[model samples]
Target chain A: MSYCVNCGVELDRTAACCALCGTEVCNPSQPVDMTAPKPFPEEMQPPPPNNRPLIAGLLAALLSLPVLVCLVTNLVFGGGAWSVYPIGGIVLFWVLTAGPLLSRKPRPVPLIALDAFAVLVYLFVIAALGGQGLIVGLHWYLRLALPIVVVVAAATLFPVAYLRRYRADGLVTSAILFVDAGLALVGIELALSFFAGHPFQLSWSWIVLISCLAMSVALLIIDRSPHLLAELRRRLHV
Target chain B: MSPLRKKSRPATAYAEWFKLDNAAKLYPAIHTGKRASMFRISAVLAEPVRPELLQAALEEVLPRFPAYAVRLHSGLFWHYFGHAPGCPRVLPDIKNPMLRPRFREKPGFLFRVFHYERRIAVEFFHALADASGVLVFLKTLVAAYLARAGGPGVAPGRLPETVYGPGLLDPAATPDPEEFEDAFLRYAHLHGPQGYREPKAYHFASTPEPIHTLHMVLGLVPVDRLLEAARRRKVTITEYLAAVYVDTLLEMQRREREVLHVDPRRRPLPVRLQVPVNLRRFFPTKSLRNFSFFVNVSIDAANGDYAFDEILPLVHHRMRLGLDKRTLAASIGQNVKPERSLALRLTPLFLKNLAIAEIYRRVGEPTSSGAMSNLGEVEMPPELADAVERFEFSLGPSFRIRTNVAMASYKGTLAITFSSTCKETDLERGFLTRLVRDGIPVKVESNR
Candidate 1:
């Protein structure tokens, strides 16, 4: 007997609110019959449970077995602590793959930070072990390697954070990423110059920076102009 | 002998295996956890459902539906159906019906029977049967249940001659070979050109509900008022409803454009609907297995803002042309010709699945914005009809399309149910409110 005043459709006797518009029933003549059976049952079937974390945990355990074997072999044979190499590599692999799988919602910024830290730890292990002719002890790691990893990680994290915060579409995301790439190249050149004990000067990176920045500017212009963006989408649609 | 008293046959009489029908071949390949090719048909009885009697009825009635009594099995090249080992148990209905069936699970059948309060619903995997076939299965199951419950005038020995219409089948009769035939292969003329590909259509943008959650909105309108509206317009009921749907979609798109601040001159994509036609009507076949095809009807906003009246004839004639036997047969031929390819038959099942899934994404999923399937009016003998109040039909969720419409009428009430995975009810509201505005009274209910 009751009708949704908003939708103009008759509401079911058991319905307390309008199903279409969510308007509360206020019929003075006929009150909602609470005891009447609902059109559908109240029981909800839960979705199947997710097995992703279990699988990821099993894979991580399998990965750890190799690290354990190498460590035991190195300790028993009395080798020069070479077990650190295998152990560090395996740990780094686990961080990159299993870390995201374990978390409920893996945010890009935190995952990237973890990965960058793992890379740095692996490099530090090599430096500490005095890698044969590859690393000049801690000096090369501190001056060149540390700064490059930091700059690259920062460059990667900036755009991801920006995109997530602003909810940017394809064009804006590409523009931001391009700008990050241009800045990272400049930072890498400066790090190299500092490591070589030369005056801070940009050289080969200038061409890359100019090209990347120009593309970023063009993309931003297209994103800002609705007419141009629509034209481009129509032309490039496949 | 009365229809209910007819002795039920044993399941051993059914063939052990069956090839997936022409239209059915795509569902198994593309079915996923989120996108299950399933639909439901239900009958609302006049009294509360007795679960025990319903179960007994299911056990008796299932043996009559051999096509529905099978489980999905994968072959080296294509998926097929094998006779299920046990009778599927009738379970209590859930708020969310038609979640994808786990074929490996206990009740290995591809279809399930459920009852809630006064309703008996059958949810079928589309690979098993289309809506028309499922409707017949549901009607028969309901008839069997009523006979078992021994409602007044619905005694096992007393039934009207008209009860065994096209929908309700005699449980005692031997399984019809015609019902199991792949009508597509039988009717296809392979030399005809393949069906043409259509341009991508526009879909509404909305927040998706969580996995396995489907929201259903049912709007019940009197069939007489709807039929009168269609009669005045000189179009069939399907065409009239489709025009109203297109008009609503047009209005929604305009509002979306305004909110997004898009250029007014930018041409909007066409609003296309996939209207499924029962091929059994056009061709001479009693196959209850998948024997249906869809016709895509569209209106482009780029042409101009079209009024409801303007869209009516366009949809009406398009449906008239699309439902022609030759057009349907050619579409069927295009579908069946690939199954006959020697190289395709030799391809591994995994590779074939990949190819079919890709084709569906490119061609099948993008061509229609949404689907509207009308099962039309369901008829029953007066003895059984008095025991039934109404019937309902609903489509399962689609991977790309968020909302789909299904219509079925029983007695005098037409239930137009909209099944959607999106959180927004704007489309359902617009559609139902439009009907209300057009002098049709709509009674709205939902499984919120």
Candidate 2:
């Protein structure tokens, strides 16, 4: 038994330094004591996230402005409806603000609702305007519904299925993040098609195809290789 | 003919073993500098060393200092060891000095020869020996030889003792292993720069720091004043100086954090310090060519402020913990192995280039904000001190780390010095200034 001279703390024979104060314990003639004061672990907390709700609300507002402007112009010049546009914009912003919170899992319910809302607003605004009249053919519905169906269904079912079906692997998490990025891109394309009114969309299809292809490749390649999966887990953080 | 290659029949060999730390591979471009370097410290005892009796003295000394007597056989078959083990020493030199060291060239044997200089010139091969072990080995070897040569003339009535180099070198006969071992190890580790940049110079044949880069400034503090200071602090002289370095680095880190807004709380920064311990307590090796290995001691930067009051006992405690005879003896046994290459897959290219860095990582990538090597309590045969004047140490920049603080004492005064390969970082400014500011009276000298 000994005491640290610097801190005056009673210590075990093996103490390298004072455990509390980091004062070196100088016991020369003692037996080897296994319990030496060792260094503490050094994992630092990340800097506090600058999470600002005001900034979030402002971002939501900014996104809603352009859609509102287009809707207003349609009402005046192209005989579009005034009421549906503002209401849809409010609902879309609400989803943008609370998508992660409201979805028990990533249901994509908000995105689907927004996609439908955008189509309805575009048709009503343009029908009132009487420029290119509101026409919702089966092809248009197929284009709009297919992506919404895949995203909403996948978002709702993937987590539950993945938990039950896929084996626990490191790469699975990052694979999921990329998959969400692909779905978000699909949502953007759908929203764009609604505003344009006349959809002669050939080239945009490639972007959707590429995003899905990349997400699948990232998943399949990462899943199969253990070494690569470890690498991905270490880097991707997701 | 060449300065580094010797004129002897059996060429002197030095082999450095670079074991990786935590089995981790290094990324490219990391600066792995030296943990410490060879203090440009030369002890000028009263008399100049005699050249005439050198070989005869070596014959008497070789059987005694076992650590200095062994020949190195590395894993690199053609370059170091023979095609088979323990082959005769008549191997031809077919190696190109210009080519970078490869796995075939690894398990390096640093050939050392104490020839053709008023002071013994130890010509070292690239991969084998570090500066501290080699320098102490050189000093001990020559001192032992001198002791033997001046037999009755110098040895007085002492027996032909070759069992331990440090023991024989000490005329005072204080067999307190506890007190001296720490001093020896501190001295050994302090011989090079504090830290070196790794990955940057990860080749065995990579250029060492410019020899001129290491410089010294010496001053005299009477033996009594130093002794008083040591007594006042209830610490040894080595402990007092070690405190200064620990404090210096701590202060430097503190100041840097304050100025640069570095969050010390993030991951407590490390400023590990290593000091070389000479293994003269257990046995004597006569050659004195490679006599010491380092005992490392480190203090985290955030632990406390740099104050002598806090630092003194800290130094004493670390020294006491590390220099226990059993630990030291085991360490010596572990380090004094005849050279052999590690069995492995393909040799990592980094290992070939970064000899010191690779070794540093193995030796616990000492995250010393700096190092302090104080070669304490050196005894100059009374007649030699008059001719030699004083001693101070200098070392090459190490692998991975950046700065070092080195000192050695003679005639009771300690010379404190710093060296760095980094032209940019201000490692020496704050702490060294503190020493002078607190009235320690540091005299500054540098090659720059």
Best by lDDT: 1
How well does candidate 2 score on lDDT at residue A161? 60
**Candidate whose DockQ is highest:** 1
Reference-based lDDT, residue B426, model 1: 90
Q: Highest TM-score among the candidates is held by which one?
A: 1
DockQ of each: 0.69, 0.01
User: Clashing pairs in model 1?
Assistant: none
lDDT by residue (tens digit), candidate 2, B240-327: 6667666666665566567767554333455566776655544443223334545565665445555568767777898888787656
lDDT of each: 0.86, 0.45
* Window of ten residues with lowest summed lDDT in model 2 chain B: B90-99
**lDDT accuracy of residue B254 in candidate 2:** 61
Instruction: Residues A149-233, candidate 1: write the lDDT tens digits.
Output: 9999999999888878887757778888888898999999989998998848888888888999999999999987879987997
